[model samples]
Target chain A: MAKKRILIAKPGLDGHDRGAKYVARALKDAGYEVIYTGIRQTPEAIVSTAIQEDVDFIGLSLLSGAHNELFPRVVELLDNKGAEDIIVFGGGVIPIDDFDYLKSKGVKAIFTPGAQIKDIIDFIELQN
Target chain B: MSLNEIIAKKFSSWEKNVLEKLLKKFPERQKEFLTASSEKVERLYLPFENEQEKYIRDLGFPGEFPFTRGIQPTMFRGRLWTMRQYAGFGTAEESNQRYKFLLSQGQTGLSIAFDLPTQIGYDSDHPMSEGEVGKVGVAIDSLKDMEILFDGIPLDKVSTSMTINAPASVLLAMYIAVGEKQGVPREKLQGTIQNDILKEYVARGTYIFPPEPSMRLITNIFEYCSGELKNFNTISISGYHIREAGSTAVQEVAFTLSNGIEYVKAAVNAGLDVDSFAGRLSFFFNAHNDLFEEVAKFRAARRIWAKIMRDKFSAKNEKSLLLRFHTQTGGSTLTAQQPDNNIVRVAIQTLAAVLGGTQSLHTNSRDEALALPTEDSVRIALRTQQIVGYESGVTNTVDPLGGSYFVESLTDSIESEAQTYISKIESLGGMISAIEKGFIQKEIQDSAYKYQKDIESNERIVVGVNKFSVEEKPPKGLLRVDPKLRDLQIKKTTEVKKNRNNEKVKKNLSALKVASSDPNANLMPFIVDAVKEYATLGEICSVLRETFGEYKENIVL
Candidate 1:
């Protein structure tokens, strides 16, 4: 199978990109092609980029506590664009309390701080 | 025999007789021990023969030139560090209550945390600020919010530190206006504005203008503060965000001091005397998990900065050479799992900061990794500092670990390594050009990746994360900002606009635009004029963004 392509993006004004860049680089090392959009990306820009890249997964990283609004908006935009198959995962300083709600809104998984890169790769592999 | 020969003979004999036998049966846990920065650590540190000369040159007494031991003569024996917790969130009124609570709880100073909208220079109602108003910190749209944020607090009595960049001038102007309202003169106000913008390009991403204009704004503050606000620190050259962005301890010191050098050079080139402003140039650093490494990083930082001031800039005033800094426990080190474990981690980091001679300190709350800390968690964090300050007995003496062989060696190692990185940056034509070329960002990212890989492979053990794992119920009662906060903040800003005089606002803003265009004109007075007219932060920053184009980041993977 061809390598799984992923779009790693930051969808808000919070510039804590340490986790996002780390995950993006880790996925690439695990034989996945990752396209990372730098900080301050809007949901529209992120959705358009994911569509342009034709990635298998869209990993949204937000540390600004705006994840509840921004994460769901990204998932909703993908649905409107008929790209719902593009798996949407979220990460960063996300509280576990919101995990179920995010999952209900179509974010397949939520990676909080202290999550290992291997666990992320395992999640992606299980999707296969 | 001389001291060198005598110690060398004794050390070799001890190593052969004791260490050799022990290592044969019980090998060390790993092939080599390394610090958090991946620097090699030897089995033991022994004093060398040239100690007397080296001590006099490098480890002089506290409060002297090359302030390696500490900056003040008496150190904590004279005064304990200011226990300033960085706290702010929700609307100005809500945050004001939190500040009063903290002050009543014995916090010595105030460190305001601005929300994302205020940090990036957007009003609460901007499209870009959707879902972000008053989320991470307090949202301030105009002078009205500033007044409420410090409503009962006296400006002259309590020192304030604002973690703001990009729109720092606007915020500083608002602070001045607030002081004026409180019947305090600008010269009487004490505190710092985090006006360092180079780090924003390198690590934190809150930058507004390109490099040339940003440097100009920083110098503008230095020049303005030198005569106008004498008690205020013009800029806080920070390595905290850089370290949080995943650079090692060495990079933290190196890049931060390099940025400091850039700012000093900019001030001098802008025709401001170094002595006038360099004394007020404060520093902010991160206190990470490694006790010795973190301690040595601080010591090394002071020595390096002292040398830079004396040798590089030819600064004559002793105060200009002192590296007074505030430290905060590392946010990146806190683990979301086993939240209670973070208290212990913060306790250790607090000791390191105190031992490192920090002028002030902020301890991270245990629940920060999960959410904004609750009042309970914030109290515990503050108490952690108090316990160490009063009970730990580490503050009884100055630079208690100054002469330890291991600590001195590590301090030396860190300083030399940091100097090497500084030289490389200098070769790359200073910090701004190096940042423009993405050199600093690339270095930090590489270190961050390596650190993550170490955690993944279990080479590094983050207790409760990789090892000693536990399964527990999800956390409860983490502070949550109401989603309706955005609406309330927008309403507040709308009301402020309605009540303020519109004609004066436009006139001051236009004058600011013209002042911003002139290279020699200081923009501080112009900013203050606009701020006094109740012009919003977003409005002031918009004018600057129009005059000086926004910075496009160099995306380096």
Candidate 2:
């Protein structure tokens, strides 16, 4: 079986890379071929890169409070390409109340603050 | 989700396979098992039993009493919190353009993020800077970058904050020179340099000299800034990066405050008045998720600082007692999956900063999880703060949730818990010793490991991660820094070196090394002279590296 390929991209003004970096490391440890698209990525660029790289999943991490706008655009771009069937997920400081709204919009899942990496691994495995 | 429901969802299968089998096979004797947080409570907060000890003497009022509610009584009501979104990247001119854009968008202040080379005191043209130059943040090589960084903005009018550590003194000198270029007086210059190298080593992995010399450099800036830059904060003792390193709210608070205490001692032992430098001592904290935990953490921080100032340092002024800080929403909380979800996350974090009573706040852009924030995304980030300042009615009352049974109760619990950490660290020695011996690092690592273990063992369920799984993948939006930024930065830096007087640069750099090598020597004066002569950041840092050896990482991990 081919190893699952995932892309973890940090898309905003937040330069704090430890969290995304650690998650990528955790994913790699869990036997996934994880690619880290380093700091400051554009939505169009991330989508094209994801397609070109043939990723099975994309992990979007933002600690900056702009998740509401950026999250939707990324999701919409994938739908425009008719490639929305791939597994996509998100994690960050998403509030509990926003979960249902995000889910209704087709966001796979969200890992809020204090989310455990092992939980993320399990979620990814289950989803795949 | 209810505690039991959450625990059942996360642990039911594991319990059935292992614990249930064990219980069925050996039902003879029931052993009492107690853990940190059993199935009964997801988070085991301090009981009301210890409320008196935690609050009565420690947490007081918003601006008075113990001032735990907040340092300012009015908070956002007195005046809206300063919306200072952090920005920097590419060549100096590009960063300058971005800064202008941000300022125009109602950014009350500026926070500059320097590239890696600059953070470690290297010029853009240095071999080490390489393709990495201007990749993460604005590349600063000489006084030219600083000049371009602040070209049109009058330094005296707008407060600027630089996020540079190891080479902070040199950077500060550049800033001071920039102020001069703008025809601003030394006394009129405002803003801050994140000169807190101690935390850099422990959390951010950026440090230049060994502890003793690094402390000396910081103290030199503290002493110099006290006399010259009256209104400027010399160092922003930061918990921002520490929290980003996977520490719990309690761990972040304890470790950051301990570092603050160390700096205070350093300033005092240097014979500087606690009041002069202490008043200018500001903080930077990470506004992560866990609304109540973060809010409680801020309250506990203010209370802790007030006591440390009045009781420990014999500070007489209220200014010294006040702990003014800048908060940035937690960057560590962002994910690369389902990128659009980050906007909601950032808004919530920004709200936490406002409610926590920060003096200045930087709302991280959603695109941050993918790359640097573009104009549109950064505008939205700034808008998040504006909406909270104008629309949200939480600021109407001082410490809006101050009297809440839950919030007040949480504040006391967090304070007491942090004290335990402080005592534990003190017993092992001081903050420096703790960091050096990896006690502080180990605590953070243990907490991170435990948190990870919880998620892996199905003891915790992250919303989109472990519980609610989506079938279809969402598209991603990632920022891409122009690859040519590195080349442009290097060319500009090299051009500046060639244009500047080489002999003067050499003379000033040598003088800087000689002055810094002496144990009693203060480096601020030489650094000021060096920047004035247009010496590159690389020149100044290389000299310091030669004079005082570079710090070696001792962390086993």
Give me the candidate number with maximum DockQ: 1
- CAPRI class assigned to model 2: incorrect
For model 2, state the Cα shift of residue A99 in Å: 29
Tens-digit lDDT track of model 2 for B1-557: 86556655657676678778987878733243212212121222323434456556666657785788788767666898888978888777888999899988889899998877788777766554544567667888889888988899988889989898889998899998988887899999889899998887767766778998999999999999889999899999999888877678888888888998999898789888998889999999998766766787898888888888898899998999988999999876665455556778888888888888999999888766555777888898889888888888877878776656667766777788888998888887889999889887666656665665666675654555555646535333445456567677777777887888889888988888789768788889999998888888888899999989888765433
Q: State how far residue B285 of model 1 sits from its true place (Å).
A: 0.5
Return the TM-scores of chain A for each candidate in numbered order.
0.98, 0.93
Task: Compute DockQ for each candidate against the true complex.
Answer: 0.84, 0.05
Query: Any runs in candidate 1 off by more than 4 Å, and if so which?
Result: none
**lDDT by residue (tens digit), candidate 1, A1-128:** 89999999999898999999999988998889999999999999999999999999999999989999999999999999999999999999998889889999999999999888888998998996
For candidate 1 chain B, the 10 contiguous residues with the lowest summed lDDT are B43-52
Per-residue C-alpha lDDT of model 1 across residues B482-551, encoded as one tens digit per residue: 9999999999889999999999999999999999899999999999999999999999999999999999
> What tens digits encode model 2's per-residue C-alpha lDDT throughout A10-116?
66434445567668877887899988886556667778888889998888886544455566667889889987965668876454545686777667888865566
Q: Model 1: how far is B246 from its true place, Å?
A: 1.0
